[model samples]
Target chain A: MFRGIVFAFLGGACITLQGVANSRISHDIGTWQAATVTQLTGFIMALMIYLFVRDGDLGGFRKVKPLYLAGGAFGSVIIFSEVTAIQTIGVTFTISALLIAQLLVTFLIDRFGWFGTTKSKMGAPQFIGLAMMIGGVLIMKL
Target chain B: MLIGLLLAAFAGMMVALQTIFNNRTDVHMGSWATTTWVLFMGFVASLACSLIFEGSRTFNLQQMQPWYWFSGLIGVGVVICLVLGIKILGPTFSVSVTLTAQLGFALLFDSLGWLGLEKVAFDWKQLAGVVVIVAGIYVFKFGGKKKSAEAVQSASAAN
Candidate 1:
């Protein structure tokens, strides 16, 4: 439990850090080029890590759905849309909308068991918790 | 403004979608291998787009600072952690926790004016926001302890 929380927390921190850094890189290179560079360096780093900590079989890729391979395609879209939104609407509104949107989509995914995920009904506490979380974000941004 | 808001939401959807896709990919391969594969594919796609869209622009790497390169490395961390996190915490819970941390750090950076951002004063509202988010998580996890574990199991199993 602790490990999961920590993992989620660290992942979140990295998201912000990477975004700020990527935007900075975009200022230096063009937006798309910055993305390419970020992905390239990230790929290199992942390749290095995979060498030492190779636990899973690479051949397993053949077992997964072909559509799953397109995850990286969405990665590019995430970068392009996020940067443009921030630039257009200002950071506060952009981030607020983003948080809400993420919560809504993720909650629906959890409820409906989308993409082969387990369907977990949002109990009263979970729903309230989500609402509070969303409220907190709105408060922070507004 | 509406378009901007829509774009932000669209980005959020892409993020959620990408995460699940990565998690699905992780089911067959090791986390690191999945990360490597995703980044490799992303690199190719983005490289192609960059060539097509940015062919005319020449980047002068001479003035580029060292820290700019670190984003990709940080991205490696993000993917690994999310892969682990989603497996354990499930999709919504994992992402909610992550989003909290993301916002918290962003708030801290904004307040401290780190990363070249203009300094903003930290006040009670920010503190309340953080506190409420923490409270929400606490409520969702421990407050409903009876259901939480089963919820987690089902989510992971289904994934």
Candidate 2:
């Protein structure tokens, strides 16, 4: 559990770092080009690791669903939409709305077993926990 | 405008969905391999989109600083961390923790005026918010365990 929280925190820090780095790159190249470059660099890095580790079978990808394979495509949309949404709706509004939307969808997925996730029913306390978290986010933005 | 709003909402859902997909894929492939697959697919998709929409536009890669190129390395870290983190913490908790940390770092960046970001004043409210988020995590941890255990049992039975 502690390890999980630490990983989560590290993931968040990486996000900020990546956003700052990507913005700089975008300023030089256009957004799409920057995205392309970033994706290429990431691909290379991951490829290097994969080659070194050589753990998983590349051929196994055929067994995975096409929808699962579309994560990368969704990632592109995420980048594009986040950039535009922040521009249109202001950062605070955009972040708040996005987080809320994310939480709601995650909850539904867990609760209803949608999108290949296990169904985890939420109790009142879980709902309160969620509300409190969202409230905290709103407060932080204030 | 409505379309934009819907897109924004969809975009948020996509983030969650992407995480779920990546996590599932990670279960089959190792984390590094999964990262490679995702990046490769994303690169191809974006490259195709760029070619189609933007035509052939060239940017002088030589003029850019070396540090800018490292963003993808950081991105690789984000993907790996998220895949592993979500597997352990579950999506909701993982997202909450990630957001809290992101907000904390964002506030730090704003106040310190690091990385060319404009300085923003920090007030007590922001501090309070951070505190509240921490409390919320505790609340969630305490509140959700029983339900989650039941879920696991039911899921196994269904399978």
Q: What digit string (tens of lDDT, one per residue) describes model 1 on residues A1-142?
A: 7899899889888877776666667766767877777888888988898888888877899998989877867777677777676556544445556666765576677678877867766678867876886787667666
> For residues B47-105, could you state the per-residue lDDT of candidate 2 as single tens digits?
77767767777344665677767778888677667666777877667756777776567
Residue B111, candidate 1: alpha-carbon lDDT: 70
lDDT of 1 by residue, B1-159 (tens): 889889988987776677677778877986778878888887788777877777756354664677667678888777778768877877557756876787777667667756655466877777687677667755655444344333322211101
After superposing candidate 2 on the true structure, give the runs of residues whose Cα lies further than 4 Å from its correct spot.
A1-8, A85-97, A140-142, B1-10, B58-63, B79-97, B145-159
Question: Per-model C-alpha lDDT, please?
Answer: 0.70, 0.65
In model 1, what are the clashing residue pairs, if there are any?
none
**Per-prediction DockQ, in order?**
0.56, 0.52
Top candidate when judged by lDDT against the true structure:
1
Query: What's the CA error at residue A48 for candidate 1, in Å?
Result: 1.4
lDDT score of model 2? 0.65
